[model samples]
Target: MDKSNFRFDDKVVLVTGSAGGIGKTIATAFGKAGARVAICDINRVAAETCLKELRESGIEAMYFAVDLSKKGEPQRMVSDVVDAFGKLDILINNARAGERLELLEDTEENWDITMSVGLKASYFATQKAIPIMDSQGGGNIVNISSVSAHVISSGSAAYHVSKSGLSQLTKYLAVHAGPKNIRVNSVSPGLIVQDEHRNRFKSSDNVNYRTRAEQCHPLKRVGYSQEVADAALFLCSKAASFITGQEIIVDGGLIIQDQWALLSNKTHTTDNI
Candidate 1:
């Protein structure tokens, strides 16, 4: 592949929830790849830090602090980015919520918050960005989905459902936007460790928890934020001009293996030894 094909020079990219974790990585990657980056996050301090980092790296970047769960904030965010950059070429809906409640004990408030951030924000952001993109002759929209969309976990009911909706939303947007040359897609990631996870395992004994968790995956290691960022970049680049309405899963092959197969492999290894 030509390295120049991945460049985003002079292009404007807006990434939501980009203060830290996967969102931060995606925003930074775009900046480094020559795109004018717009970083949006609910946390002012973290957003400032990310913005500073991007600028110091000689990347054109700006920061916006907005609560995406609000009714008009998504549109407002898109407007702000366009106001700053003069044009929007790519939109990455990477923010998410609703990880604290279990299905049986879930509240309406929790569900609303989850759906608002994880799903609705993406919808309205794309709604607002489409015209701008169309005017610019076309653009890319990448929704950061989750493996939860396909595999169900015990506690995260709303989170899973919201992601499922996001995947479907990606397809719907693709169908509607294709005629206008606006491509819509998603990247679904699994078990990528971030700052919060690192903080939780800072203690000496708990530090090995990540290693233990990595063993469960076929790759024998967890994924990094950069991996997901790379996938997003590819989907948005001209390299994927023909691709739309699809999802690329970055799971280290964890979701493909069956419990029976894993157990059988372990049993066979023990017997062979």
Candidate 2:
């Protein structure tokens, strides 16, 4: 397909949690596609590094260091992006924070932190960006969700709940924003291991972690941040102009396999019966 269909020549895109990992990859993709990118994250140093990389690549980019977990911060971040870029064309809510705690073990503070950044931030950011987008006649919003929303994972109760809420929030916002020419959607990723994660598991004990993880997926490999970024870009591009209120799952078909199928090393043949 032609790459121009995905180009964002004069558009302004705001991506939260873009200091590193999938968020940074999304911002980088947008910057490469000609969009004026805004990188938002709690980590000032990492955000600055991403900002420098984008600028060095001849992409118009800025960085915002804000705690999305705090009330009013999401709105303030939107305001800052608009002030810097003159307009907001696309908003990617990709920042999230979570604690490793089961349902009974989860603390109120941890739950609040998870929901604040994962769900509440997306809601308020969309609320603040609506008017700006409406003024421009239209815009796009892509919430970064996770497979945890649909499939349960051990010790991730709060994170899963927040992601589920985010998915539903996408649908809700799409319904309200459709008439205003604004599109809302979500991209759910599974088992994406980025550079940081690789570093964390570099020891001999976990040297084969990636390989083992790949075996869980039908594709026989784990996903990359760029793959998720591509999905986000497509959802916001002209190619998906008619698409809204939906979710694109970028999981290498991990969620679709049956338990037995995932466990088996060999393919089954009906003729064997």
Candidate 3:
């Protein structure tokens, strides 16, 4: 693994929902890799803060505040980034409406919010970026999907369905966009703890969610935002030049386990072999 392989010099990257959490980390990671990053989020304040931090770290960055859930906002966002940066080399569709509701209990507004930001926005943004990328020779896109798409949870109906659609969208775009030299793919993360939630999830309480989550993973631990970012960087780099329309699952090996075996092996240990 040559360290120079990850270098993204002269590239311009736009990351959606990059105010805080995983999106912020991904934006920063790209900046560190020598890419000029555009941090876009609905929250103006947080986005500004993130922009300051990136500039302070000597990473060339700018900020764009727009709600992707609104009509035409995604297209406008892509246009805005290109306007500022001259060209768009990479697009990371990391924004999503975080709502938790079951199908029976869900409202139309809630469902629409989730679908709008998670799936629709990504689609439109890519639509806008495709032509620009084709004109510039080529580009890359990484949809920030979730493991929820494959494994369902009780109260995450909209989230699951939206992610499922995103994965399918990735495939659809890959086939159509490939002829233009633009690559599209997705990274589905599982049980990732963002910076703000790390302290709370790490608490050593009687009912420990982290401990329980660790058992479900073969790696015996939950994942961090940086680990997921690394996977994304790889897919966008020349290392994955021949890859497209694929998904790299960063789930600590959770989705691959046999349900029956996991149930039987309740007691878990992480001793170094």
Candidate 4:
């Protein structure tokens, strides 16, 4: 099956924002399946922790502390990966910046930080990795965009714009890299129950925001990092070889449903990927 083909055996992957949530899950999956992964993040502690977990499971992993929002950080990180593994077969750009429901009031400082980390980082990171991939004759790049890229609400304006830019970046890379046999795609997850989101409501009396968000989704629930991870594995794997410049929506199918349907627990689940 396509799943099996996506096996990362002997492949070298570099995952950014891999400290927790979907990033960590994706890294673990690759590690479990046998891949040399360079786990990167702004927080070295978290990155090391993730690496330790992977090492405990016997996955060949490395950790690096890099601030993705910095201008040249992407290029530098790519260099680190190549130096560590001598080859980079996959690049997963999953680092994001946002605070839900705080877009309109967002400061310029916050906007720059969000956009740089979420969008620009992806661009330069992929740019740096492309040459390496070309030298190897081919490779894969899977970007972690979000449904927010398309369906925007009154929250995290920069986050939304950044993700939208990311989708376009994915398309551009796909078209440009096709000639070199490298495939580029993106995975857009819906409101998933990740640690960051959970942490947001830690002090709230009603700490069930995830549940509520999930309920609002057409699928009757939010998604897991693992689900999005699975989607990334698919796009990066040979299973989606013929697919490029395409984004796989990993949400609970929320984009299509109307507001009433979403609030009422009605869902449409006939999507066949």
Candidate 2, 61: how far from true, in Å? 0.9
- Alpha-carbon local distance difference test for all models: 0.90, 0.91, 0.92, 0.85
Candidate number achieving the greatest TM-score relative to the actual structure: 3
Q: Which ten residues in a row have the lowest lDDT in candidate 3?
A: 264-273
Model 2 residue 123 distance off true place after TM-score fit, in angstroms: 0.3
lDDT of 1 by residue, 121-232 (tens): 9999999999999999999999999899999877768899889999999999999999999999999999887754666655677757866667778777788889999999
TM-score, candidate 4, is 0.89
Q: Which of 2 and 3 is ahead in TM-score?
A: 3
Clash pairs for candidate 4: 214-222
* TM-score for each candidate, following the candidate numbering: 0.93, 0.93, 0.95, 0.89
Candidate 4 lDDT, 1-273, residue by residue in tens: 655786889899999999888899998888887788889999877787888889998999999889998879999999998998999999999997656548457788888888999999999999999989999999999999989898877777888889999999999999999998899999999877675565564447655865567656666776888889889988888777798899999988678777775457554544522
Cα deviation in Å at residue 139, candidate 2?
0.5
lDDT per residue for candidate 2 within 153-200, as digits (tens), equals: 787688999999999999999999999999999999998977567666
lDDT-wise, the better of 3 and 4 is: 3
Error of 1 at 12 (Å): 0.3
Clashes (backbone N, CA, C under 3 Å), per candidate, total: 0, 0, 0, 1
Positional deviation of residue 36's Cα in model 4 after best superposition, in angstroms:
1.0
